[model samples]
Target chain A: MRTFEHVNAPDVQTAVALLGEASTEAIAGGTDLLGELKARLRSPQRLVNLKTLAGLQEISYSPKAGLRLGALVTLAEIERHPIIQERFPILAQAAASAATPQLRNMGTIGGNLCQKPRCWYYRNKLFECWLKGGDKCFAEDGENKYHAILGADRCHAVHPSDLAPALIALDATLRVVGPDLDGELSLEELYTKPTESRRQMTILGPGELITDIRVPIPKNGSRGVYLKTMERQSWSFALVSVAAQMNFAGERIADARVVLGGVAAIPWRARDSERILIGQRFSEGLAERAVEAAVAGAQPLRDNEYKVSLAKALVKRVIIDLCSTTD
Target chain B: MATKAVRAKKLKVAIRGPGKTAIKLTVNGETHELLIEPRRTLLNALRKDLGLTGTKKACDEGTCGTCTVLLEGKPIYACMALAIECDGKSVETIESLSKDGQLHPIQRAFIAEDALQCGFCTPGQIMSVKALLDENPNPTLDDVKRVLSGNLCRCGAYPKLFQAALRAADLVRTGR
Candidate 1:
């Protein structure tokens, strides 16, 4: 409940300029930032509101320009958009399955992508985990049944978004804007590990803002699916999730993008699984092999040994279900 | 020395606007003006600021639906919403459902079915049921379950809740 200055930015440029000149932070829907500020995880001298900016709320599609999802597009809009559901069912499924109806109505796609991690220790502010610039990770030795099982060195927290792994599988690109600067980068290049830098998880520079996310029109004969396993049927993060996209030619997998969530420091992509399915037909056996390959190099901590097995099982289920999908 | 210097050089910026922001909102049907800080959540501003304590604040991080309220006729988590953001919108809390001390149809149905145990989650459940009935006057048992999944009753009153919602739907359809 601390006092902080608030300013409403009417445009991206003005918002960026405001951020550059003062100790400011952006507030899109305030679903995440306000909570974080209240928890004292972040202390900004000023809050730059992004809700008034026009044209940042549209969800547009083109055969040429692909799908352009603006920064302020709510999760409900993404979930219910006909074109998104038809063309990119993976994204739609991930969006529709997030949090709950009320959260989906208020949470913006940009905020969901840019929101901080949901690690219990990190949010509590009392544990001082390694991801929070502290020397130790409490989840490393504590109750880590939800921690990562892949791609962990010094930190083992899993990526919290169910949409992020699906977006990675769709080969989406991100467009970021800041003061006098604008650029686009693939979604793969957007995330980095805590081992790489303890300070930030994304490649966005300090004043940079995510403006839009674009997904190229995938070629014909492409099919994708997102499957998640949670302890509860609703209102909980995934215990393990998989986003599988299979490009097939006469039942043989021509191309595949297999990304694993709830099991890594980043959205872990299983390149080995992709390599194994290059010419092989996707069956229950092949799916099992892919799952084995997906969790091949996992080094589970003391309390998170079950994540590796759970991740393998979810990946196998997703691939099996995806193979059953028709063009 | 360093802390004192930092505090001395800091500008006196009013975090909220000059004085508390006066937000004029129409709750249910009545208009009211309330002074709230920029950081106060809509749930707090409604309950603490205006003394409308019908909207509960359980699991304030948007997980539980105890604080569910209608913003311009759409259900949203009141805790995650800012007070200033509701300036010109119509907010409907649980207290607004009763007309001249008569319980709303959903509230009456809930009581008739004994759908509440401790009654902590009753208001949110009733508000959500109101929204569901507003959209779909005749909802199936599955539809009622889908809409009420976000509202959790620790006492396990879901069977009664489902029955009450079904009964409310029937009443709304039959005009009884």
Candidate 2:
């Protein structure tokens, strides 16, 4: 690991001031940042520690505001929270399926959402691909097995978060705090198109920090589910995952949101499939149609042709499972 | 000579890697205060700084759990944790399990079951199993497999190790 200054900040104001001074990075729980630093992927001048900051490890809910998840709240806490388990079981299920029990105990929600890609080329510091601001994207032709099938232009890397798909499916909003102002923004707006900036992720600026994630409670008769298919059962990233949440009136779907993970540069929201599902009765044929619409026009690389089929199969499976689930 | 005296002038300098930070950690009911570099991992601090060498280091990249230790009664890969970050926490290694030359029940069970061939990964496996049993004493076979999946043994003693864990749980339940 490289030599860097470590400053523990007791409050967000002081942490923001420290970040404003130089090339400083915030460290919450240090589960992801420390691993990146050790791999020589990041070399910051200073590390601003946020563990000492009070009131940031909260997982509280309000009748008016719904669920408020603090940045410092660990994945284990979210999985174990009673309100989250009752109201948003999909979010809890997603949290429970990530990494191992030990990693979940140490990894915070903010770190999981803001983590860098797990691509072997991007993580290996020696390879300067397009995502790393270089000209060539190595995954375009070379070893493109895990590359994106959707939203692939300059870069084809896949989004690795299991939580983002669930959060976006629930129509969540993020509360961002920056040097200028603080406000709420939808999770869909947090992601940017791959063509816009190949190097940057969310629309968050340099000095902005994610303070909390607020998920609105669904109306009555709403059901949600998150399902992930990975090569290994534990301690591995997902190959394909689907998050489905729908509001049902009798046997027909009223409103629905479907987000696919591990298949695109961002949380790939299945807008066409969602539109098809609305005002339609839940059945095997309906799910098959939604899956076909969701995966249409997919552009798969040489080695990742199976992802298109795998993604379609997962979407159909998850939708059928959700339809079978009772409130 | 005057030249010799001038050449002997003291030059106070500090040459350290990333500067040394004082961290106080408790292990096995003993508190140790030591100066460690910022980049020093908990595995290095345990074996090199504090001389508690029970925790083994294998696949330092966090894949293998040979460096597993209990931090606040939860098993974590020591190689992935920085020593400086655990300044005010409690750590438990395999060395702290026995009392007064008496083997812990888990150790006795492992011996009785002949759970070791080379014994290289024993400490970490024991620590992981201990942490799991502490939390869930009567864990099912599936639970045991899930919790101990992180730790690996090259000797392929997983079956015997599983028996040892089950025996240890029985001992804990029966007060044998």
Taking the tens digit of each residue's C-alpha lDDT, what string does model 2 give over A103-137?
A: 77677898788877777888789998887878888
TM-score of 1: 0.93
Residue A186's lDDT in candidate 2: 91
Cα interface RMSD of each candidate: 4.9, 8.7
Find the candidate with the highest TM-score and give its number. 1
Per-candidate TM-scores read 0.93, 0.92
iRMS, model 1 (angstroms): 4.9
lDDT of each: 0.82, 0.82
Model 2 spans > 4 angstroms off: A194-198, B1-17, B114-118, B154-156
Candidate 1 lDDT by residue in tens digits, A1-327: 466656667677767766665456888888888778878887776677787789999999998988999989998899989999999999999997788878888888888887787878888867777877888878887877888888777776777888889998999999888766799988888888876364556767666888999998877888898988888887778888888887888888888998888887678899999998878887777777887899998888787788888888887877777777785
Candidate 1 residue pairs in clash (backbone atoms < 3 Å): A4-B15, A5-B15
